[model samples]
Target chain A: MEILLQQIVNGLVQGSVYALVALGYTMVYGILGLINFAHGEVVMIGAMIALTVLQILLAAAFAPVLAVLFSLLAAMAVCMALGYGIERIAYRPLRNAPRLAPLITAIGVSIVLQNLAMMIWGREYHSFPLPFSSTSHQLGGAIVNDVQVAIVVIALLIMSALMWLVHRTRLGRAMRAVAENPAAAALMGVDINRVISATFMLGSALAAIAGFMVSANYGIVHYYMGFMLGLKAFTAAVLGGIGNLRGAMLGGVLLGLIESLGAGYIGDLTGGFLGSNYQDVFAFFVLIAVLILRPSGLLGEKLAERA
Target chain B: MSINKSALLVAFGIALAGCGKSETASNPASAPAGELVIKIGAAAPLTGPQAHIGKDNENGTRMAIDDANARGVTIGGKKAHFELLSEDDQTDPKTATIVAQKLVDAKVNGVIGHLNSGTTIPASAIYFKNGIPQISPSATAVRYTAQGYKTAFRVMSNDAQQGKALGEFAARVLGAKQIAVIDDRTAYGQGLADEFVKSAEANGAKIIVREYTTDKAVDFTAVLTSIKGKQPDLLFFGGMDPQGVPMIKQLRALGVKTQFMMGDGGYTPKLIELAGAAAEGAYASLPGVPLDNMPSGRDFAKRYEERFHQPIQLYAPYCYDAVNVMIAAMQKAGSAEPEKYLPEIGKTEMDGVTAKIAFDEKGDIKGGAVTVYQVGQGKWHAVQTMGGAPAAKP
Candidate 1:
């Protein structure tokens, strides 16, 4: 009972973070039809930048709330510029080449960013400084900390705001147009380049927030922190239907819940033959099952042939 | 087309010249006449999560080489100018083997590290095959020394001794009856935990549950939550501080008030800094007596801090001792060759900053000590010292 409840809470908080990162992959996939593998590095950069800024501000004895806000904005701004630069420098030049070129370039960009980060930050894990001591609140029998609650609430708000921005704004319409057909969108005076770049900036901004949430939740950040997370979030995106916004969100949360619940119950399920250390296996297993059963994902639409 | 061809030719010529320059740089002809440049290879995870400890090992080895050179060591009546060739294994076993082979191929006179037991065990085979003496400063898995590899040696206590001390302390000293154990599933962590469980159970403490996690994992919520349900009186984790810090933090966050403890892998300044408030009252066992109690330990620590501009992390003193012991063997044998000086290491008996350096038949340190430390007011304080000589004022 309480174990189940505790697992659910854990799953939800973790899932929300995955969903935020998944949106970056899904948005880029939707707009450019290219999997921006470097998106994960963008999240890492965001966290690193935010952490550095926060540390400096805190050392200067700034207010905690204001310091957090300033650091987040700084991270978002840097990530936005980075996303734009990556698309311009790496992808734009290969736009007319074979699809594989851009895909490989995305991986190259990711590697470059990772090594660059390692060189700049070194390899030690930096502890995320918390302004307030995390106090746990009990619900029934499970414990929920202030950080976890903030993560869930903030993620929900940002995700909802994203939903509104993508569906109800002029930029959203342009983005949808660009995703539908860049040639057609350009013909319709959509300015395909601007729409694409905007989509990337928007996604990167979300990635920055996701990075902050991850560091805050886990209380530690490292140069290699983004790789596994990006891989998992990408998995969540694919499980939700790679190019679908709602599918990505659903997949992220579902994957998180599945991981937490699977980890929580695996010991009992296997009769102690396996342990929670095999937690990673559950995510991939469910991915394989989902891919085999529903190729288009739970909420993904059937692929449409374009003329 | 001709311009492009000439440009290509020029670039090729420049690349060849660059290679030639490096070749000349490493050429022994550049050394002063009658001076033998003896290369000592050091391998450790110099670029990953364990980089801090790895760098500490490298720095200690470097300091030893510098000191040896300053003293103008002579081997076979030749003035020996010691040179350090450090390689980053990134804490990966595969990389460790590659680094070991690289060191052997470079014809290094001796090897100083390959820090973790997981790395050291695999790399030891490579060193053994090449007949190169390898000394580990911190690899404490009992299997490392028990492998019958004469080339392998360590300066610190093995897991068998450390685990027994930890187990006895948990049951007898702390009086924790119900205990939960978690290991990172690495050779060192798992081996230490297994030994700990054996001794703890033998001491009449009931083992409630055992769990495993990877060294790379940052979150332990699910595992801690599950363990919380068991309501164990104490949770003991056998892993490095990178994982241990988060496990303890997450354990506390889950509102579990169970006592937390870990093996030497958790006994690092980084643990206290990262774990912060969560680290309070946490117990960890570190092999060897406290630095303040060692002969010349305070002086060595002062010199190390002055040189490195940072306080000594765990195992630096041991690393310093391992290098000096290897060099001492070379001096005793009157030759720098591994085969000639290898036997001298077994016969070694010298006072090190950590302890009186000596090796048993298995190449394990003789009479190695283990000390249990508890974090209080954000600093680790030694609560109990087990085995080895009585504390001597530095």
Candidate 2:
């Protein structure tokens, strides 16, 4: 019972991070109807920005909270600009050309972003400056730390803000209209290009939060750090139903829970016969099983473009 | 007509020969004039996940080449110059095999190569077949040295010692009754995991969980969840830093409060960053020469910083020493000729940056030590250097 409780708590925290990153994937797919493969790199960029700014801030002797805030804002701004730029230059050029064209371009864009990161950072592991990095607190016999708490709390806060921004603003309505019918909305004077750029900016800023949290939560990062995270978030988007915003979040969290639980329970039943290294495989196995059962997705609506 | 056509053909042949002769004569002396150049090959993962470490190894070799050239060392009673031709394997076995062939085709006198155990194991066969004496400063998989390759040797201790030391730490130091074990599933990960499991179990820690994960994975939630119920006293991971860091974060977040243990594969500056503060107080077994805390390491660190203008990567000093040992062996053999240095290479005891570099029978480094390190406040601090890895806690 205690063990189950621990896994659940842990999974929730892990799930939240995946969910935040997944939301960006789901939202961009909702608005643009395309998979922004570079979305993950944007998240990586966010983390890097946070890393660099914090280092500089700390060197100048700012308080921890101030440094974190400064870093967060800096990272968000950079990520938003990067997302807008990527969409405008890389995706916009080949948007109407062919389905394969944008995808291939996205791959090139991903590679280009990764290489750019490598050039700037010189292929070393960069650590973020996080407060309470040295403090561990006991929570009901479960050893919890400040970084994990920050990962969970900060991720949730970003999700709430994103939820509000997408649901409660004029721009949000414009975004929804664009997603529902880009051609029709453009005819209705919705500024299709501006709306699309705004969508990318908003989504990328949220992803930046994820990048910051994950790097701060985990402890180390590199240029190509976003590749696997992006792939997993895409899996999460699919699990919840592609283009479904809430569903993406749900999928990310559920995926995280399933992985932790599967590794813990299925692993033990194997009687040390199966080591803990296959935890990742266990998560994906669950994802495949879920996909086979649900087809479109767990929460994928049957109508209304599934957004 | 026939005489004119034949004459034209002859003229074309002469022109082609003239072009070829010029090309050969101009580039034949790639090095400066009046220098006896000795070519050496090094293969490393210059552009992959492990590239940072491999780059250090390559640069270390470069530094040695520079040092030797600058010293104006005489080889075969002739003033010999060294040239290091380094190739990027990108951490792929297939690429590494091709790179090894290319190096062999270049006819380098010796090599220091193939950082990864997965790449090194297969690529060494190619090097051995080509009769090139190769030394690896970082490849620590047990089978690498056990493969019976006369020309292949490593300056570092293998997984056997590394795993035993980690096992002992878990059983004796941690004093945990039940322990969970995991690996990254690479040759290095699995080998070290096996060694730890054997020693940990023998030391009376009930091995509760044993699982595997790929290096590319970021989530261990399922594995951690399963281990949570078992309530293992310790969670041992036999993997490198990339996996270890993220795994630590997930473990802490998932509320799996088990203490973490790992082999030298987990020791890197990034692990502290990857796991953030979570990695604080975690221990790992680094089986090899403890050069970082040594006087030689300190001096080498200064020299390296001065040369590279950056902090050296984890195994930089070791590779630097590997070159020194190879060059010293060449000097001992009294010739730079491959045949002369081939047999005498095994009988070297040169003072190197990592250690007094010497190899025993079976191509194992003689008198290697295992050092234990702990992550403290986002930095690595060496705790103890054990003479030989004790057999688990027992």
The top-ranked prediction according to DockQ is 1
User: In angstroms, what RMSD does candidate 2 have relative to the true structure?
Assistant: 7.7
Q: Which lDDT values do the candidates have, in the order given?
A: 0.89, 0.78
Q: What is the DockQ of each candidate?
A: 0.68, 0.35
Candidate 1: chain B TM-score equals: 0.92
TM-scores for all predictions: 0.94, 0.85
Please write out the lDDT profile of model 2 over residues A1-307, one tens digit for every residue.
Answer: 6677667766777788889889888888887778889888998989998999988999999998999999999999999999999999888877677677888888888888887887788776666657644476777766566777777787778777878877899898898898888888999989989988988888899888889878776667688789878888888888998888888888989877876666667655776666555556655776687678885677876545432
Note the clash tally of each candidate: 1, 28
**Fraction of true A-B contacts recovered by candidate 1:** 0.62
TM-score of 2: 0.85
Q: Model 2 chain B, TM?
A: 0.87
**Residue A266 lDDT in candidate 2:** 64
TM-score of chain B of each: 0.92, 0.87
